[model samples]
Target: MQQYNPDFDYKSAAEEVLAIEIAGLKQLSQHFDTHFVQACQTILNTTGKVVVMGMGKSGHIGKKIAATLASTGTSSFFVHPGEAAHGDLGMIDSNDVVLAISNSGESGEILGLFPVLKRQQVTIISMTGNPSSNMGKLADLHLCIKVPKEACPIELAPTASTTATLVMGDALAMALMRARGFSAEDFALSHPGGALGRKLLLKISDIMHSGTQLPKVTADAPLTEALLEMSEKGLGMTAIVDADNAVIGIFTDGDLRRLLSKRVDIHDTTIGEVMGPNPQVAHSNMLAVDGLNQMQERSISALLIVDDGQLVGALNMHDMLRAGVM
Candidate 1:
């Protein structure tokens, strides 16, 4: 590697690169015409997945495009052009749409598979810098990803062209996402292990302490007993319930702090006398993210899950944090 140059004007060089890439993107935006709409409609109308194929740097971009399409409600996956020629072409179905990426629009490996693709009568959408190139000519649909220039000094490496291609891919993915009316819940279903998935898919019942794990005490219980239950359950709070186990009040660590300042007789005072009334509650089916929002808006750290006014479960900020729902 070249040694770091102290006087290289690195910041200016980086800014120039960004400016060129931005210009390429602007050029790309002008090409989003009927062809873009047709591409979206083709993918939406298909009963099979979008099989993306490319080579070299274009291949790398293809993988990302495929991933974005898959996560945004369009089922798609990337297939290496070289590999496809070697028997992976069997992955293609007649109902599938082939998205072929080649900056020059003349990748031999990609073009070599076209005859077979056409024989199978699969729809082909080609993304390229040259619409007149053979691969583009053979495609049923052509999307121009031509950029003004490459950021490379010699103009050999794919730079602005790849950026334009990736943005074009994003435009297609988002347009299809909106066209399908894909909701966050649907996106979360495909990304169940991600943070957004946890926020959208996890319910209050999924992480809340329930049954014997819940901290609760009878309304007539002494304040000291409520504290003992809170300590035992390790929830930092305890619910005060009536004879039917219906939640009437709640006492938390904050309440204990205030009670301590007032020199209240914990042994003699009943929990019902000092506990907070009209405690904010949620149903078991409430989303964990919504529960987090409730706690945040009310300036509280915990929430009680109740069903028909009966105390059922409890959760706090710690639980939300642990569940990755915070």
Candidate 2:
């Protein structure tokens, strides 16, 4: 008999599932030995894409694994077994490698499509719990992801097994990525809309203000005139440049307040006299996230972009903030 309580025992239920899945993953570590290396070598050596296919929960995991592989330098895509029967198998090239995922290693839909893939001489990689199953036996390389039991209390749901399979798939993707020397820039290119992409792909030139938009004035200009440029531009600061348009100084809103504290008259002072000399500058080629770092470190909100010592552009924290780089 069980007593009903207002507090459902979700914590214990979740913890038990996690504990079982963690153990299942640990068991999978042994399978990542020589067989795993051979599978990766086969995929990397071939000049072809990877085709990941499965059904049900395994299909979901296979889709994500395929995506991870694609984004990390390997060309790959997911194919539903049912879709393959309906004609999506045309996406697979003769040179492509087929990666089939099945916890039981006996999915009828996958096995039914195997003959055609085999006839085309496509290299096959199988991930399954049973080594003797038809899918495992027909593969060129096999990864065993056997689990002791399901984490589900009824021992019917695919919890621990699916988690183990997904982790193993990720391990394979990353292993191939590192083996091929895939760099951060490569990863950034495949994920240009995400955080790492913005950090690595967005250059200072892409977001900086230039031409008439740059807040700047000559050294001989009056402080009052520089103030007008700063206000017109609305960046709260103006760069003081020389005849060659090389940035020489910067006058910020904070600096204006400091001058006011000294009782200096803006109308009488020259821009050069009030500006901070040789202020820090950035290059347009530098990454925008790095520019954000420099700004934070210097306790400033904007930076001047100079190329070969000539002022080319300017940027503020607002630009980076709007770009979502921060």
Candidate 3:
């Protein structure tokens, strides 16, 4: 029977595992050389996708590697080696590059697809701990992910080696990202459903309230009228525009509170008398993130969008939050 100890040093064991994995990653870094460069060149030159394949634990890591590569501008997908041997080999084309993973470089399922890949004229890049093994020998290029030891206490499970392999895959993906000049905008394009996509791809014009939705009161309008526009628009603010529809000032809830504190008559005062002059403004094309930064830096909650020196639209902190640009 297996023994259980309630006093086991769980924290120490976890720390030891982390230390071993860190050491393995450091060792893996030392193997980056001409082979790494050649692998990158081969993937970059391929006209088709990078088909990643592996078995067991390596297959799990291969799926993640393929995902990272795909998101970072390297077109790629993961294919289980076992499935590939049974008619899934049709997914690979002569123009595609294959990235196969195996710690021993001799996984039977992966090895079985070698002749088919070779016959299809597909370029093969192998990642393994043993460069002398069959998969490495048959590959057009080989990447070494050898580690000094496994983090598992029994030295049988794949722990440190898998960590090192993941780090190597990340390195390759980032190298390809840099070489392809993949910008944050490009990344946002690939991830359009997330907050990052909103931050990078959303512009001021896309979310700012304009035209009939805009809260506006001429600079000569009475403070009561401005307050009415603010309440009707529900933006907590109103733009004080001049005869040419240019924003000369802005009247917000903060200004109204200050005006009330001064015992001023809302019915008697014009918006120009109580409005904030030269309020912070944004251009229609400005990124919503930049607009948010401007609002944060100035300690203000609202911004007027201007185009060619004319008030075009307006939005406040609440709008930014609602649009997911906050």
Candidate 4:
């Protein structure tokens, strides 16, 4: 078994790699000019989707770029260059834009599709390291992602070049997002199953315990009755309401513990006398993420749901957790 070296300069080696990649990224930024703007404008004005194609390492980067573009309000998809020659070219429409990635700008697989893309009248945007190469010369707009050197010691594997490509893709996606005025709600619509979606889309009404599930009692009710309501509902608290069912106050497990420590008589005391007045309340339509922020800010565990000053429902931290909004 290979033993771990306690004196190994792993941190130094990692820093060296990061330094090389950072320099490569700085170099890539200098190459962004009129062609980059033209590429963005082409995609922004495109009526159809953006088709991304590459081979090998470029293919992997192309897939991620496609995903980023699609998720950020751009309709995009990745089609393997090899597969495009095998009938997948039908996926491309004349109105769409093609983004072909090749580190050397001479990938035969990607180059082979240029004729068909041209024949279909689709705009070709090429991302390559060399602007003088065949694919770059053929492209309607060429965005160069040239890097000074590979981060790999042997200079064989793609490291700095891939990072620069990924960053350039992100820049394009963000530029498109800003131009489209893409909001968080629009992003949530596309990512309805992700945590960010839950945070933005989930409302208190969707998760709050309503109707008979609410732990509530009249303000004049005995403290023992309030405790019974809390225990029966299993919410660790009970809302103290007036005659019109408007929340007047709230009694919780913390209040019970404090009362017990002070030797207060729970059997004889009225809930109105011991309940906390003016409890924090939430609207039914309020976002669950906002509720979580309220709870954290106020250092509380539960909130009473109200509408037009009448108690309607209730929820706690556990509900937020179960809904994946935490």
Between which residue pairs do clashes occur in model 3? none
TM-score on alpha carbons, each prediction: 0.93, 0.92, 0.96, 0.94
lDDT for each residue of candidate 1 in 1-326, tens digit (9 for 90 to 100): 87987888988888999999999998787789898999999999999999999899999999999999999999999999888888899999999999999999999999999999999999999999999999879999999999889998789999999999999999999999999999988988988887888998999999999989999998888888999999999989999888998988899999999989999888889998999998999999988999999999999999999998789999999999999986
Error of 2 at 212 (Å): 2.6
* Model 2 lDDT tens row, 78-99: 9999999899989887799999
Q: For each of the candidates, give the backbone clash count.
A: 0, 0, 0, 0
Candidate 2 structure, TM-score to reference: 0.92
The TM-score, computed over Cα atoms with residue i paired to residue i, of candidate 3 is: 0.96
TM-score of 1: 0.93
Decoy 4 TM-score against native: 0.94
Residue-by-residue lDDT tens digits, candidate 4, 191-268 = 888788899899999999999999999978988899999999989999999899999999989999998999998888
At residue 265, candidate 3 shows an lDDT of 86
| lDDT score at residue 204, model 4, on the 0-100 scale | 94
